[model samples]
Target: MTVAVLFALFTVLLIVGVPIAFAMGLSAVTVVLMFMNVPLVLLPQRFFSSLDSFPLMAIPLFILAGNLMNVSGITAAIVRFASALIGHIRGGLAQVNIATSLMFSGISGSAAADVAAVGSMLLPAMKKEGYKPEWSAVITAASAILGPILPPSLLMVLYGAMTGQSIGTLFLAGILPGLVIALFLMALTWWKADTIGGQKHSRATKAEIGRAFLAALPALVLPVLIIGGIQSGVFTATEAGVLAVVYALLYGFVTGKLGPGLAWHHLRDAAIATSSILIILGGAALFSWIIAREGFPAQIAEALTTLTSNPYLALGLIVVALLILGMFVETISALILVTPMLAPIGAAYGIDPIHFAIVTIISVLLGSITPPVAIILILACRIGGVDYAKVIRPFIPYFLIILAGLVVITYVPAVTLAVPRLFAGYGG
Candidate 1:
């Protein structure tokens, strides 16, 4: 009865078009008030505690770093680099879109930021080269979702903070699958590029290639600094974020693009983005407490184990469930609510939490590109000035390509564990 009421409230609020954060808070409060005798004071406590997490500090910094990279002209350099590498291919600019996302993903970690940065540049170029606006928008949208699954990803940081998993390991786990998705998306784009051969392929001059590489060099160094710092134990994940911000500022200054006033503007933007995420997180934490206090976790664990003792089967079910939940709830909210419950079940079945974290984060990220409530896709639609349905139609191939990559990362534990194992050798 309690579980039913909880879900009922959640569904009703969602259907009514409440913002996800408020809906989560309202449903949680309604359920808590209805199901138990807990005092209202606890709501404030949970809200504060959720944002109080030290590790969560990474979220804003990562978001800021991605935004700074976009504003500081890092994205442009990387796009040029991608263009030089893939522009001579059959479907050149289309191929460049995927490759550019893959490169930028390592730096930014925010999918919406990825689309905003990469889409603005690539969409216009692709259109000028004679590709349909719809196809151009769709392809770029599909490619941008890659950022949240790649290293330095904001989603991974949120997953780690909410679930208490190792952030470094999750970051490492993203590498192989990120690359695999990049390769497959590039192939798909190549096929499409072949079909639409309006642009003349040009091999970049040696000087042009050198100039692009040099231009991208500062931005490319950010991922290395971050991942390397974490892997080497030189800095905690939180500190790596601080380093990212400092590096971005320094790069901006050195390039003469960031003056005294520009630094303040970037800082202001970072604070706003950070506050938005933290506010949602606070609401989610309150909701998570309600669900947990109502015994959802225990009930779920018992039900899952009873239904199928097989770890693989249980994992498959959990993946499908998360994917579906993702279509409605925002990714961070889903992780905050579900990770606390499902992670322990994974542990009970001998699954590594780090492995589960990678799969879970990646699975949730798939939602950002999925239909109905795809946040990144919506951003792309607005930026490219295309209709959502038109954007979604040609996106099927790229979706399947990414889905294939997700399945590979999910079932094959080694794809996730290899880097962590090699770097730290702690997973034995």
Candidate 2:
């Protein structure tokens, strides 16, 4: 009854256009007041308790690092390097868009930052260079999702925080899966070159390729620094986030790119972004507490026993339900609401936590590029000045390839588990 009221009220709030964070908080509060005997103080206590974790500090640190990188001009250097490697190919800009996202993902760990950073530079250039604006928008949005699938992922960090998994192991787990998505997207770009409408560039000479790589080298080293430091016990994930910020600042100083006023603006922007995520984190924490208090996970597990005792079917059903739920709720909000419930259920069925985490993050992230609440797609269209309707047709092939990738990562646990198991001793 409590779960029913909580979900029903949350659905109503969402349909009526309340912001997700507030919606979560309000629904949880209403359910508690009406059904539970706990005092109202539990609300604020749970909310702050969620934010009080030391590991959670990585959230804002990463956001600030990404912001600093943008203001310091690392994004363009990465794009230049991507262009040199693949700009001669058919659908060159689209290929470069994917490549740039692969590299940028290592730094930002966010699809929004990737789309904004890479799209801001490449989208206009692709449009001016004769690529259809709609195609440009579709490709940019598609590749941007790699940000979270790669190491240093903001999504993975949150998942680890919520689920009590090792964040370093989770970071390791993302590497191969991230590469697979980037490679497949590049292949799809080549196959769809004719439809994408971009001109090919002359292949760069070896010297040009070396120079571009040199230019982007500093930016490229961030992921290695983070993963190496974490795996070697040199730092916690939170400390690694500190290192990322320090590195970005050092690069800015050496390049003379970041200045006082610019730094202030970027810092302010990062703070605003961080505040939004933290609020959502807080609200979801309260909601999760209420649900757990009701023994929801056991009920869900018991209910699933009737549906099927087969773990594979259980996992499949969860994925499909998440896919549908994602089409409506924003990815992070949906992740927070469900992960606290589903993760334990996954363990109850004997799924590996790392594999489950990867599958769950990637599955929810698809929402960012999908409809009704396609945040990444909307950002891409807005950046390129293309109408959203124009990109829907162009988006279909990329979406299908993404779905195929998700299916592989879902059923074939090795696809995501190999690196973490090898390096971080995961599942041992």
Candidate 3:
């Protein structure tokens, strides 16, 4: 009864267009007042405790680091390096789009940031080079999904804080899966190059390549500094985030890209972004507590196991559900609302939490490109001056490519776990 009311009211609030955080808080409070005997004070208390986590400090720090890098002109350097290596391919600019996102993903772990930073720069160039606006926007949106799947990912940090899993292990686990998605996008770009009709550049000379690499080398070393430090036990994920900020600031100053005025502006922007995410998190945490108190996780686990004892089949169902949910809910909101419910079910079926974490994060990310709530896609389209409807047709093939990659990551544990095993001697 409590479970039904909880979801029923929550769904109603969503349909009525209440903000996600408010809907979660209101639904949880209503469920408590009417169905459970729990004190109302628990709601606010749980909300506060949820935001009190030290691991969560990584989200804002990573956000700030990514922003600092963007303001410091690191993104242009990475793009130049990627172009030198692959800009002569059939779909040269398209390939560069994928490669730059892959490189940028290491620094900025937000898909929206990826689209804004890379898409804004590349979209106009692609259009001027004879590529259709829709194709340019579609490719930009598709490649940006790589942002959250790479190491130093904000999504991975949030998943770790919520599930009590090792953030370092999760970061390590993300490497291959992120690369797999990038490869798929690149393959699709290569095959569709002639159809898309983009300008191709001359192959970069050794001198040009060397120069670009030299320019990007400092930015390229950030992921190593972060992942290496974490894997070597030199810092926790939260401390690594602090280091990332310090590194970004130092690099900015050394390069003369960030002056005091620019630094202050970026810092202010980061704080605003951080505040938005933390509020959603706090509300979701309270909702999570209410669900847990009602034994929802155990019920969900029992129900799923009864439906199918096979872990693969169970995961397939979850993938389908997440894809659908992704179309409606914001990714982080969906993660907070669903992870607590699904993690237990995965465990019951003998799935490793880290493996499940990788799958879950990717699934929600797919939502960022899908319709109705395709925030990243919308941003790309707006930037490219293309209609959202026009981009949909071109987006279908890229979407399938990413979906296939997600399936491979889901079924082949090694794709997600090998790096973690190699680095930490733990395979999840």
Model 2 bad stretches (over 4 Å): none
What lDDT score belongs to each candidate, Candidate 1 first? 0.82, 0.89, 0.90
Would you list the clashing residue pairs of candidate 1?
A: none
Ranking by lDDT: 3, 2, 1
Clashing pairs in 2: none
Model 3 TM-score is: 0.98
Candidate 3 stretches with Cα past 4 Å from truth are none
Top-TM-score structure, candidate number? 3
Residue-wise C-alpha lDDT for candidate 2, range 1-428, written one tens digit per residue: 99989989988998899999999999999998899998888789899989887887898889889889977889999999999998998779899999999999999999999999999999989988889899899999999999988989888888999988999999998998888888888889999999889787999999999999999998899999999999999999999999998899888878999877877787788788878889999989888998898899989988997899998899888888888888888888888889999998999998898888988888888866888779899999999999998888888899889888888888888998889878877763
For all candidates, what are the clash counts?
Answer: 0, 0, 0
Question: Could you tell which candidate, 2 or 3, scores higher by TM-score?
Answer: 3
- Candidate 3 lDDT score relative to the true structure: 0.90
Q: For residues 1-428, what per-residue lDDT tens digits would candidate 1 score against the true structure?
A: 87677678877887889877787788878877877787889889988988888888888788777777777888889999989977888777888888899999988898878898999998888888887777888778788877887789888888888877778878888887788778878878777775544586789999899999999988888888898899898998999999998888888878777777877776788788888778778877877776677777778878998999998889888888888877777777777667877877888888988888878877777866788888878887788787888876687887888888888888898887888888867563
Order the candidates by TM-score, highest first — what do you get? 3, 2, 1
